[model samples]
Target: MVEALLEARNVVKQYGTVRALQGTDFSAYAGTVTALIGDNGAGKSTLVKCLSGVAMPDGGEIFLDGQRILLDSPTSAQRLGIETVYQDLALAYDLDAAANLYLGRELRRPGLLGMLGVLDKAAMRNGGAGALANLGVRLPAADAPVGSLSGGQRQSIAVARAVAWASRVIFMDEPTAALGVVQRERVLEVIRRVRDSGVAVVLISHNMPEVLAVADRIEVLRLGRRVARFAAGDVDVEDLVGAMTGALEASALGANDVEANDVEAGAQTGGEGNTNGGNGR
Candidate 1:
């Protein structure tokens, strides 16, 4: 609430027939990791696409540090200092770590006669490696082809790419998805480093344990709508699942003020009826 670095409100997205996202509100402050979690089909992907500028929302407004702005394209988002690291990473497997790191923003060195026909390979190597380290990601070697690296290593490279160029908020989609235990931890460590470096991070993940471990706040979406939000320490996994499943409202978590209907439901359920009959049913 201390003036978010990035704030999105009432964002809506739709396909020709499918309304993938409904009105939604989300924000991430500087130096914090805001995790967005939900069950499958909870509009997580659609919301992420809108935030990343892959798909512009048909409704709602977005603000950067209290200033309303327009993001019509991916380049527009980048121009606003919002960088995104997708699950696939969009990296070229054929390239090495340094090459992959500088995929779009390649380093160039001036050649003789002012004809710069050379890629600054040395500079990229050193700078890329240092950036990776800054994000707490240690690659085996900067010269190693990205295709040869393990899933975790590749993820680390992808996250490092975002942090290295992002001057504001970084959106990470499943940063540790499919990674082995050690590799997952490594990716999480890098995410934490990014947060500590003062960049706001929006992490999209299905891994609740990982979310619980790294998130400073959690947002839950259900039926294509944002149903709840809570400070990390103020809520538990169960509360998040309740919001995602439509059993809880925003107040069920840490909301200070409860609406009339929300209060009535709370009275009947004792604020715990969201559970599934105490069984998996």
Candidate 2:
């Protein structure tokens, strides 16, 4: 089996009296779309934050390419080729597409101008346009402000920025949310292209059909811990819902049937006692 490009083992995170991640384990392979699914308050966001280095885990370990690593900040994660496209898109509404793409990491003019902090606008614009084109993203105009673009176009720009910088993995939180059908499909196509380019895409979304449609693997989280893992082709919406809601143990399908369907619903235990269902190999 291929070693996971990114892996989190027994991760734990707490906020005051609330425990956000309870020994949750996650893995994302290179060149695959792994969907992280759960209901609200299921710790999906908490885990993502930890994995993306926006937040630190209270305990447990994270590995990149089989070596343990510490992510002290978002910059640290980015330095190691990890990027996140948040649900908010986080693009500057007033900035044009190219500017937003290189918002924090702007290219500089050469020699004295670069030393004087003069940005190479033309270089940035050409680079951003090429990145978007490689992802098959279409914008109405190369110089248009991101705010002027459609929801999908904006989302695509955010994704393109992440993909342009991320050499290993990209965490996309609801890339298709609030988008029109055409826009959503366009974003999904970009996701497929990214995966095909050999970058691990960890997708977090509540839309079941969309998850099933794009995810190569699925991991279901409930009450701050992962309760099931499945190959996307091996499960349907019902199975995914059952796993997220803990209905797999109570539903008529029963344990044997779940096994038959190749679902590894975690042990019927609580808290840290719950184990990962199975590796979505």
Candidate 3:
């Protein structure tokens, strides 16, 4: 496999009374949707916070293109070309799509007006509109307040904004949650579009079918640890549910254990069990 675009190794995070992450390891590859799934309280949220620089991990190494780096704040992550769309959407309710897109990184007029805090609305609007159109997201209008848009449209804005500025990775937290079936499908299509554009995507979702349908690979977290990583096409919903419920430890494999077992099984079975070899189940 190619080196991961973003990686977290042996990451640990803890609150005073709760240990949120326990030596967790995660990675995102360019042009793939890596779905992170786990039961509630399984530390998915904690891991996301750490990865997006919303919170600092107590200990661990985070790497970008194999180089260790620090992500102490959301701004830090953004500067590194990592953007996160939180579950809350994180937009100003009254702001238009373009305004929300350029919330903190707004364009200003040249020279004196720029120094006087004059924003270049036309430039920002054009940029935001272009981004949305490029991503194939349909919205009523780019200048309409986000609060006035439908659930899917609002989600699309959030995703489009992330895609516009994100050059390396995008973290999406339950992007289709609480939406209608159509809206969910639209969001899924947008996710595929993003991945196809060659940006690494880390999706945190509880929807099993969505994960199975959209993810290239799936990582399951159990009790603050990554218990299994599976190639999406190699596993079924039953397998995923089993891993989540602790009913199928046989299929749960770490990076090294997977290869080791495949080799052992191949030797024992005269290479017949090797059919699924290299599938990374």
The residue pairs found clashing in candidate 3 are: none
lDDT string for model 2 (112-162, tens) is 999999999999999999999987776878998889988778888998899
Q: How many backbone clashes does candidate 1 have?
A: 0
- Give me the runs in candidate 3 sitting further than 4 Å from their true place: 250-281
**TM-score list, all predictions:** 0.85, 0.89, 0.87
All candidates in order of TM-score, best leading:
2, 3, 1
Instruction: Summarize candidate 3's per-residue lDDT along 1-281 as a digit string, tens digits.
Output: 68889987767777896767766778789999999998999899899998999998877778898988788889999999999988988988799989989989999999999999999999999998898887677677777889998777887788788888888999999988867897788778888988998999999999999999999988877777777777888888888887776687643433323232321222222222123222112
Candidate 1 global lDDT: 0.77
Instruction: Determine the C-alpha RMSD for candidate 1 after optimal superposition of all C-alphas.
Output: 8.1
Off by over 4 Å in 1: 111-117, 249-281
In model 2, pairs of residues that clash are none
Question: What TM-score does structure 3 among the candidates reach?
Answer: 0.87
For all candidates in order, the CA lDDT equals 0.77, 0.84, 0.81
Alpha-carbon deviation at 181 in model 1, angstroms:
2.1
